[model samples]
Target: MSAGRAQAFWLRNLTAKIAAIPMILTSLVIFIGCSIWTVVYSFTSSRSLPVTDFVGFRQYERLFGAHRWSLAVENIAIYGVLTLVFALTVGFILAALLDQKIRFESIFRTIFLYPYAMSFIVTGVVWQWMFNPGLGIQHFVRQLGFENFTFDLISNRNTVIYAIAIAGIWQITGFAMVLMLAGLRAVDDQIWKASRVDGIPAWKTYVMIIIPMMRGVFVTSLVIIAAGIVKLYDLVVAMTNGGPGFASDVPAMYVYNWLFERANLGHAMAASTMMLLTVLIIMVPWFYMEYGRKNKN
Candidate 1:
């Protein structure tokens, strides 16, 4: 580019750039700086305080060896996978139904999206009550007719993670639906006409053409749900408290417990660093594909 053109590009959004300077500095100093600090401390033998005595991967070794941490990791894996699959499937189905130009569309959208507005804690509490064996679904069902029915999944060790996933899917599916609906609406009317002209089925058009076109929206929903799955502490605390012998424990809860309850800052930092790395592994490539390549072009 010519010198004058380069100068014009730099000065094109001068005021907006000036306004963004504080935010950019804040992100660099707060987010990146604290992340580096945390990773550094993860190598140390700090307990109840931040210490300089670096012990390499000793803290990480202990973190991985702990049974509680293992359970937490396993639970998160199961929960995360189930949440992702169900949220995407259910959300897309709901969005497709809404796209049919049905009556009371806004009312249905509001009803569906209402759960996302509620805090995770509130969702957890409400679901906990509904899942309570004595006073909830089980009792209500038995009173009606069936006395042999037992719906105590929340209190069962084997099924507690599934219960957590139920609450998570309920609260997040609506948000996914909204995103998918927006993506569906963005489809060109001519594309549908072309598909119809070719005698293509609606489902085939969606699967072969429309979904591929909505790739960005799908990625956005995936990232949003994945982030929530990783940081799944609040709902677990409110509903299960990692109970039934740490059956529903997740990584974030493990990190918090090690840091505060166990007073093992190094271990907590190590766990948190692992979570950060996991998020980056999932996000960095998507970021590059979505934005970096566009910039280069």
Candidate 2:
């Protein structure tokens, strides 16, 4: 082709790239604008409207007014800690068992991991039925002459959160097992042989040696689990809908109500932002300590 034609083609391509720049910039601007708008809205006295004037920190003060915020916070703490502990424990155990040349390792791994693939909405519905006193284990057991059998935690106000935790652990631990198993498989086989030759009990080897070596995996799993907890929503909505009163109310639900039902967009932003901040607070230090400090050396 002639140089003039080639030059014209190059000029057209450059022009197109320049024209596309504004679209990218516009998208970024919109995101930033919304985020700033949300924070600004949270401070206004406007309810059910796009409040422009600022009302200082009154929205934040009101957020702490009733028992709802504190109760939701308490529930989050309880649920988060319990789910983390139980899921990690169960996942580790299952992964370890499967790693030991189990007879049906493939089948067992699939069985353990299948629950992770299902959405929490379905899992929640199934668990709700299982926890039902009338149609579930409680009823079946009572019919077997154990009339005292009672697994009605889902119906009870005080114990409902634990019931939710049961489902959380069930769905999450399988995925955790997959992560842990991958980490476990990455371990050098030489370590296992050496431990065996040195007469280290299998359980002790896991506790003392294997676990320490798997710190990276555990931390990775914990970060992922913590993120899930901070953003927890679907299971609660599907299972109990934060029912039997406000017993199982979470920050996510609270934000949703404020945004839609209560029409308090500003307060919704504050509530939702807190969720983000909470995750950041928990993670930032750990990330710095684990990764940043290591890089410094």
Candidate 3:
């Protein structure tokens, strides 16, 4: 395209470009500008307020050294692994079952996807109450004359993170199912017919052909879930509040406590920076795979 053609094209879309300017500026200022500000401040020694005193990587060193921060990292690691495994597995299984052309298929899909429509806070609160020993499943089961049953996962530090993972899975698995179902639906019908005509079992067909074909959907769902794991805050707050002695403290909660509770802007920003780095680490490769490879081709 020549400069004249580009200029003419711009003029042709001038009104659309003018309308997009506000959205573009908002993204620049709110997302890019704020991220830059956060990263810059993370290198400072600001306490309670922003400051110009550059402290190198001292804040980050302190952040990594903190036991609470370490525990938070560990908890998130466990939670992330568990949530990714279970959510995707269970979601795919549910989607596969529904794809069998079962009766009331729409109702089943609705039931599975209903939880995804709920806010994390609501899911957290509901799960929190359900995990309450005195009033929840434990009590109800004991009332059934078991009398010695104990299911206080939320109260135990050793298993609180797992408990959180359970709740997170419950909320997110539905979303994964919907995505998987869409991918399944998008599969060429002739593929299924060919598989059946070849005398291949359904399971073998899905494993060898269908799943491999939904590569984009799987990658997309995995990345989305991983990103959610990195930003896990509100659910923790609503469920356990990182309780059982910070056993379930995730990085987001760690940053929040430092920023608001401890009044340490630099420390908070350092943690936040690490989180942003983790997200970039997850996203950059995906962007390269999705766009860079296509462009190269």
What is the RMSD, in Å, between candidate 3 and the native fold over all Cα?
2.7
TM-score each candidate.
0.92, 0.87, 0.93
- lDDT per residue, candidate 2, 2-31, as tens digits? 999988877887967799888877777775
The TM-score that candidate 1 achieves is 0.92
Q: How would the candidate models be sorted by TM-score, starting from the highest? A: 3, 1, 2
Q: Estimate the TM-score for candidate 2.
A: 0.87
Candidate 3 lDDT, tens digit per residue, 50-123? 99899999998998889999999999999999999999999999999999989999998888888888888998
Model 1 is weakest, by summed lDDT over 10 consecutive residues, at: 285-294
Better of 1 and 2 by TM-score: 1
Cα lDDT of model 1 overall? 0.94
User: Against the true structure, candidate 3 has what lDDT?
Assistant: 0.94
Segments in model 2 whose C-alpha atoms lie over 4 Å from true places: 1-33, 289-297
lDDT accuracy of residue 70 in candidate 1 = 92
Say which candidate scores most in TM-score.
Answer: 3
Which digits, one per residue and each the tens of the lDDT, describe model 1 over residues 1-297? Answer: 699999999999999999999999889988999999999999999999999999999999998898888999999999999999999999999999999989999999999999999999999999999999999999999999999999999999999999989999999999999999999999999999999999999999999999999988999899988988999999999999999878889999989998999898999999999999999999998888889768988
Off by over 4 Å in 3: 1-14
